[model samples]
Target: MSASNNTADREAKLQRNPHGDFNAVEKSRPEFEEDVEFHYTRTKDIEWVPGSGATSDDWKKHKKIAVDPYAEGRDPLNNYKLLIAGIVPRPIGFVSTESKAGIRNLAPFSYTTFVHHDPPIFCIGFASSVAAAKDTLANIMETGELTINIISEWFVEAANYTATNAPPEISEWDVSGLTPLASEKVKPPHVGESAFSVEAKLVTHHEWISKVTGKANGTLVIVEGVNFHIREDATNESFTTLDPKILKPISRLGGITYGRTTQAFEMLRPSWADEEKREEVKKILEK
Candidate 1:
C-alpha cells in the first residue's frame, strides 16, 4: 500500500480502539530488525553509486506542490499550522525582562534570530496579541533592557515552563525555580542555569501589519548585545567558538516536537583560493 493509504489505515484503527496508550497500535506491527548501532544514525565515508547508463537530466523530478496562503477557501489555523510545521528546527530565545516597576518577566520565543554578529545584534519577535502594555515586550519597552539566555538540555524543562501566559504582576521565574544571575550592564537578569547569556538593550522594533486585513500581527524587536557571558568549559581554545557537544541545545520542531543536535555533518564551500577546487567545480558546470 502507499504511504498515505497506510497512514489512513492507522487512523482508522486508532478510531476503532481509542483506549490505552499509542503503543497498543504499534504492538500489532513487527519490530524493526535493522543492524543499527548506538540507537541513532551516524555519518560514514561515502561511495557514490556506480552506474553506466544515460543519466536523466530531470534528476528525480518531484511534483511541485503550490500553496496560496491567502486563498479564499483556506483556514487561518491551517496556515499557521503548516508554516510552523514546515519551518524545521527553529532556535528558541529564552528572554528575560524587567518592567520599570521592577516586575520580572521570562518567556521563550521560537521566532528569534541573530541579525548580525558584529556589534552583536539579535531579534526576538512577539505576536501582536501581546502588544497591549504587558508581558515581555511591554517590560522591555518600559525598561529598555533585556537578557537572552541559551537553553541547554539540563534546564529545558524549566525554560519551557517560563512561556506560560501569566499575569503582568506574576513572574514566571517564581514557578520555574530558575536562579537569576545579575547582568553586568542590563537591568534584567540572565538564567543562572544557562551556560551562555547575552545582556542586551533595545535598539528598535518594527510592527508587521497584514496586507489583507490591515491588522497588525506581530512586532520584531531588535536589540544590541552589550555583554556576552560564556561559560569557560563550553568554549574552544580561543574561547570564541562554543562546543556543540557540551551545549546540547534543543530546538523547536513542529507542534509539541523538539529536535536534538546529536548528529551533524559539515561540508566546505568550493573556494576560488584553491585552483584545483575551482577547476573541479568548473568541469561539473561544463557538463
Candidate 2:
C-alpha cells in the first residue's frame, strides 16, 4: 500500500481504539483533572462538647413567648381580631329575628356558611355574649323563626354596627340607623339596606364544647330558607343572580382584616370534554 494510504488507515484505527495504549491514555487524562479543587477557607474550629452546663429546664423559659398572643385577652375586640384574621374570607350572615314581645333584632355573623341546597339550609355560629346572642339567638329560640339578610359591600358597615354591644331590648336596626322592611313569611323585618334576604325557620341547633373555658358553649342554629327577597336588578326571568362585583359581598379574614369580593370568574367542566382531552394527551405520549 502507498505510504499516504497506510497513514490514513492507521489514523482511522487509532481514532476508533484510542485507549489501546493505557500509559498514553493515563497521561492524556490526568486523575486530578477529572475534578477541580476550589480555594476555600476555614474560619473557626467546630468541636462537639457534651451538655455545656445547659439544663433541659432552659426550654421552659421560652414557654411564655411561644404562647399565642391572642390567648392573653378576654376583650371582644381582640377575639374578633384573631378570628377575623385567621378564618379568612368568611361569609357574612345578616340575621334578623323578633322576640316573643314583638321586638325586632338584626345582627351579622362572619362564621356562617351554606350547609345544604336540597332543603336550602345554612348555619351561623354565635357566641353567648351579652351583646350578640341576647337579641338574635334569644329571639330565635323564642319565636322559632329568623331571616338571614345576605350582606353586600354597600351595607357591610351597617351590618358591622349591629355587632356592637347593645342593650337586649335595643334594636340594632335603630342603632345602626338602617330602615327595616317587612317580610312576607316571617315577622322579623329584613334590613332594608341589604341587597338580598331569606326568611328561614330554626330547623336544628347544635352545641359545641368551648376550648377556652372547657365548658359547653352556645348553640349553632341551622336555619332553612323559606322565602327569598332579591332586588329588582338582581332578579332575572330565569334566576335571581347577585353579581359579586355589584353586590360586593364582604367577608371576614384572620385578624381584624375584612375581604370584599371585587372580582369573579367562572369555569365550566363537561365529563365528555375532559375525557376527550385526556385521550388526546395519551395518544400523543404513545407516539
Candidate 3:
C-alpha cells in the first residue's frame, strides 16, 4: 500500500466504539470548514452565487421521516433520546439557588427558556429525585427566589462540574471553584464568573406528572426578573445586544455533547408590501 493508504488504515483502526467510555476517544476537528462559515451579509451576498435559492420543486423532491409522537406503544426512552438529539442545540441555564439554611446550589438545566419579557419571566423545568424533590426546585419553592447564570466558554467546565450528583447539604459551588456575588434583588447569589446573570423572584410554578414514569416528576417554575447583570466586556454601548464573540456561549446537544456558537448568518425579512414580492405573489396567485 502507499504511505497515504497505510495512514488511513491506521486512523480507521483507531476509531473508538460509539458505546465506549468518555475516557478513551480520539478528538477531531469539526466536520465543517471555512467553506461553511456563515456569511454576515448573507442576503446581499446571494448576488455573488448563481442558483443559490432552493425552490418549491427542490423541497418537494426531498424524502423525510415522519414520527407519530402520540403513538400508543412508543418507547419513551427512545422518544426522549430522539427529541434531545433531533433538537440540534439547546441553551443551558446555569441556575443558582439557595436553601432556607442559606447553603448554595448550582446546576445546569437545558429545559429552560424565556416565557415572557413584559413581566420579564423565565422558566426552568426540573425533574424529581427518587428520594426527594430536586434541590434547586425545593429551594425555589421554599424561598421564592433564584438566580440564573449564562454559561460561557470561559467557565463551561466549572459549570458542568456543578451538575454532579451530591447530597443537598453539600454545596456544588464549593465543588465548582466558581465564586458568587451577593444579589441585590434576590437572596441567592449570582455566579461571579458568568457573563450574564439574572436575579429573579419566583412568580409561580406548575407541577405535572410524567407520562412515562407516571409520577409527579416534573416542575415548571416561572420567575420574574428583578435585576439583570451583564459583564461590560460582553455588552454593546447600549447594553442591549450581546457580542457572541466575547460571550462565547455554550449550548447542550445530545447526551454528553456540547455545542459552541462559533458562526452566525443573517437574512432580512422580506416585507409583503415590497413591489417585487407583491408582483411575485400575484404571479403565483394567477397560476
Q: For model 2, which pairs clash?
A: 84-253, 84-254, 84-255, 85-253, 85-254, 85-255, 86-254, 86-255
Best by TM-score: 3
Q: Per-residue error at 207 for model 2, in Å?
A: 1.0
Q: Is candidate 2 or candidate 3 better by TM-score?
A: 3
lDDT of 2 by residue, 1-287 (tens): 43334435544543433356856876886453313222334422323122223434567667543435446565434544555666678888888888888878788877788899889998988655322245788788778898887787666777888876566688888888888898898888888877778888989777766566665545688889998888767667865476554455677766434675644434335465465566554565577
How do the residues 1-287 of candidate 1 rate in per-residue lDDT, one tens digit apiece? 43334435544543433345757866887864333222234334332222323345465576768999888877555666677678988888899999888989998888887889888999988755334434788887777899998888778889888866567788999999999989989999999988889999999888888656686657788999999888888897776888787777878887666666665766446455574455455676577
Minimum summed lDDT over a 10-residue window in model 1 is located at 45-54
- Give the winner by lDDT: 3
Using TM-score, rank the candidates from best to worst: 3, 1, 2
| Ranking of predictions according to lDDT | 3, 1, 2
User: Which sections of candidate 3 miss by over 4 Å?
Assistant: 1-18, 26-62, 70-73, 129-131, 275-278
Taking all chains together, each candidate's TM-score versus the true structure is 0.78, 0.65, 0.80
Q: Could you report the Cα RMSD, in angstroms, for every candidate shown? A: 9.1, 31.7, 10.1
Q: How many residue pairs clash in each candidate?
A: 0, 8, 0
**The CA-based lDDT of model 3 is what?**
0.77
Residue range with the least summed lDDT across 10 consecutive positions in model 3: 32-41
- Candidate 3, residues 1-287, lDDT tens digits: the string is 43334435534553423556644443444443334322243443554322335433566777998888657887555566677778868889888999989889999999887888798999987755322456788888889999999998779889989977677899999988999899998999999999899999888878877676576656788899999999998898887887787777889988668887877777557665674455555665576
